[model samples]
Target: PQQPFASSTPQSSNPFGTSSQSTTFSNNSTLNSSNFSNTINCNPTNTMNYNPTNMNPSSNFTTNTFNTFTVNYEDPFLLKDITFEKVEKKTAPFSRIVPKPIFSEATMKPLLNLTYRPPRVTQKKKIYTEPSIEEARHLKEIENLVIGFEGKGRIQYIDKISGTELTTSNIEDKITFLKNEVVVSDPPGIGLNKRARVYVEGIFAFSKSQGDFIVGKAEKYPLKAIQERFVYSLKEDPYKKFVDYNYETGLYVYEVNHF
Candidate 1:
């Protein structure tokens, strides 16, 4: 308009590429680029194709379809309406209460017969008879005589004529009168009711008779006088005075040769 204000140099070129559009900026304005106007397709459809050649041959893949299930609920207290029945219990059948006997009746019959038989009648057998009192006294006297004869110098028989002591020859026959019961009455003047016997086995007849005389006078004379007479008679008449050797000693002395 004042001749279109002319400049001396060409107009400085714009640093940004030239656009026909203009931009405006203010205090409450917003900016938007042209790329922002292009929106991404957020809800997209799968457009990829299945390719068999690109898949691995060793892979195991499966397609499984499961059926759907549904659940229903009922009252929790339904168990209270149910009823139960009672059953009776039975025991085993009864067996024998006692055991069988150890012994049978057939086997025990013989034993019972033996036990019930009649009692036997046995005869009375006499073993021995008891000795009488007189026989007992005689046996005791003989036993004492045997004891006295066994002692030294207690009783002896001597030969009147030979003046030697006489001894038994057969010792087995020394006790001859023990088995035989010989009764000799007491000497005549002694007034005794007793009985005795003297036997000197294996002696001379004269010595045995002298033994009898001495044994008979044993009740009358003291044993010392009788022993003294055995030696004193050797100095007197061998046969006659020997029996009457010590007749005058005392009351106990007796004429045994006459008796």
Candidate 2:
């Protein structure tokens, strides 16, 4: 083998020497046995030039490049794409105004004569007539037979026609004489000219009697007498007409002339 050509420059023991030949040896270049006979040339401008021989045109290779950039602006600011629009303002409708009415003076009229006339008073002649003899006798008989009890449960009535002494404990027995067409005299000393009816005191007990035949058969009996015609006060002058049996207590008063 011919002795390998040696360079005139000093040989360095460092594999990565600062020589141009060592700087040109990069990953992009290939080393082969045929390239050993060729001499390499390097430029001082740090650029590389390579010519490969018998390289396949269909060889697969890939290269990628990336570029990065940075921008700076004020924080919390809106972008240029953002826009604002104009808005329309709304107003309320106006109210209608009303006019006041005018007043006119009224006319006055004359007063008319409104005389008030008094009504005529008529006076009738008074005619006084005496009572008939039969009427006088009947009135005397009623006055004599108007019997009243002196105390409770005591009969003080006397027969006017027969002149017989009558005594009974039953109230029905005392009122039996007045059942037949008897006339009640007006209360004495009243002088009011008002017709009188017989009022019996404590006679309402017979209204609830179921055994008293005389009280049950009497016309217009003392049914509801205690409720309808009961006299509340003995102080009232109207009770003078009442034939009170219990004159001491004077509790109940009932009208019994209809019976």
Report the number of the highest-TM-score candidate. 2
The C-alpha local distance difference test score for the whole of candidate 2 amounts to 0.34
* lDDT per residue (tens digit) for residues 1-259 in model 1: 2222221223233334332322222232223232223223221221245345556777676745576544334636566567888989876555555667788766444535545667789642221112323343434222222212321111111212111111232222232222112222334323121222223222111234355434323444355465556545443533223222232331121111211
Give lDDT tens digits, candidate 2, residues 1-259. Answer: 3223433233354334334433222222333323444444443433334334326776666654456544546534546657879888866544324444477547767585567867689552221112323343434333223334332222122222211211122222323322212232323222111233443333433334654322222335464453233333332445344444332343333332122
Instruction: Provide the lDDT at 93 for model 2.
Output: 45
> What does the lDDT read for residue 205 in candidate 1?
12
TM-scores, one per candidate: 0.13, 0.15
Model 1 ranges with Cα > 4 A deviation: 1-60, 63-105, 110-134, 143-259
Q: Lowest-lDDT window of 10 residues in candidate 1? A: 157-166
lDDT of 2 at 189: 26
Candidate 2: count the clashes: 0
Instruction: Give the clashing residue pairs of candidate 1, or none.
Output: none
